[model samples]
Target: MTVFLIRRLMQAVVVLFVMSLIVFIGVYAIGNPIDILISPEADQIERERAIEALGLHLPMWEQYLVFLQRAVTGDLGRSFAFSTPALELIVERMPATLELAIAAMGISILVGIPLGMWAGFRPESLAGRAIMAGSILGFSLPTFWVGLMLIMVFAVHLGWLPSTGRGETVEFLGLQVSIFTLDGWSHLLLPAFNLALFKMALVIRLTRAGMRENLLMDYVKFARAKGLSTGRVIFVHVMKNIMIPVVTILGLELGSVIAFAVVTETIFAWPGMGKLIIDSINQLDRPVIVAYLLITVSMFIIINLVVDILYSVLDPRVRLKEMKS
Candidate 1:
């Protein structure tokens, strides 16, 4: 376990380095922020001063080295647009994004797994076919479009739920979240459902596939031969084996949910990191953009590490394989 963790940590460091280089270079090529930062009529000396102050006077490589130095000390520079530390700005909005992502994940897992298990257990049933069809539709629909339709139907016509924004948040454990309040949930349901649909469909498909495969394995047949109750056979014998893959996919997708929630946040006007990054990009705020992307890369790496560790714990074969290596 120690060796495995050490190897993963080393790999994560390399991945972060590569991602930082790519993000810094890519952001630099977007456009000169000096154009937006300084007045067009500013004198040459003033322009040069602004450039130096923003560290644009240095070569890109030197600037990257400076960034790396500061990053090693837990600094990713400040947002040019907001005049705040990049990490601080991202952290402020993180709870909103995190809560939304987690809510979406909850919906996906809670609803998708049961439906998928039932569909797999009774593939020939009418309800099973319907569930499969719904999953396909869930995958096919665009998130933004679905969000709009939901707003139009629920908010405009029925007036059942709020159309946009994170509503009525109460602070819990130093983070403001809406999950605890009824009014807050009314605001969350639409966007969370919109964000969850595709992932939910994915979970459904993954669970169904695993269920079908495990059901046909020799152990399943042996359990049946022991005259175990059908419910016990399916839930205990089949579900346990199927969970290994299901858990892996869900763990990785959790990172994606937080990282790529831009469209849903945009449509819903949610005050999350996704919206912040969009605005930063539009304003050519290199620090925030770079910081956000690098942080997102770090998140994926961390989640992958967690999933790998969970993989070993869930299946002893993985630990054995790693030890042999």
Candidate 2:
């Protein structure tokens, strides 16, 4: 186990290095921030000073080296647009994005699994057909449009929920979270569901397919013949087997949920990192953009690593295979 962990960590380091290089180069290619930072009428001398100050004076490789040096000490550089540390800006908004992503995943897991299981159990039933039909809609509709429709119905017409903002929040475990307050939840529900809709449909489909396949397995029949209760056969025998794939998809999707929440965040005016990154991009804030991308890459790598570890736990054969390899 220790050797496995060490090997994974080494791979993560290499991947991080490659990703950081890509992020830095990609952000640099976006355009000269000096164009936006300095007035068009600014003279050559003024432009030179601005460029040097922002380190555009250096070659691309040189600049990346400097970036790596600073990054080694936990400095992601100062945002040219905000006059603040890029990481600090992201960290401030991280909690909101996290909460939204988690809420969405929770909704997907809690609602999709049972509905999927039921649909699989009785695929021809009216309720099962309805569930499947809903899953199709969830997959087909665009997230931004769904968010807008939600705002229009709930906020514009019914006036039951606020259309934008994080609403009220209370600090818990050093993080500002809205889930603790009723006002916060009222603000949270629409966007969470909006973000969750697609993932829920995916979960429903995957779970249903897994359940259907498992129902016909010899083990299921054996369990039934051994006088196991239907609930036990379903939950303990069937659901347990299906969870490997479910967990794997969910683990990887968690990172994507955070990264791609940009659309939903923009539509709902969500004050999360998604909005922050968008603003940074428009301003051509290189430092903030680099920081955001690197952080996102790190998040994906970490989540994937965790998922690999989880695989061994879910199926001991996975660890045995690794050992044999």
Output the number of the TM-score-best candidate: 2
Q: Write the per-residue lDDT of candidate 2 for residues 1-325, one digit (tens) a residue.
A: 7887777778778888898898888888888899898999999999999998988999999999999999989999999988899999999999999999999999999999999999998999999999999999999999989999999999999999999999999999999999999999999999999999999999999999999999999999999999999999999999989999999999999999998899989988889999999999999998899899888988998898788778789886788236532
* Candidate 2: clashing pairs of residues: none
Candidate 2, superposed: residue stretches over 4 Å from native? 320-325
TM-score of each: 0.96, 0.97
lDDT of 1 by residue, 1-325 (tens): 6777777778888989999999999999999998987889999999999888899999999999999999999999988888899999999999989988999999999999999999898888999899999999999998988999999999999999999889999999998888899988998899999999999999899988988888899999999999999999998989878889988999999999999999999999999999999999988999999999989998998888788778788877777336532
lDDT of 1 at 175: 88
Q: Give the worst 10-residue stretch by lDDT in candidate 1.
A: 316-325
What is the TM-score (0 to 1) of candidate 2? 0.97
Lowest lDDT 10-residue stretch of candidate 2: 316-325
Largest lDDT belongs to which candidate?
Answer: 2
The lDDT per prediction is: 0.91, 0.93
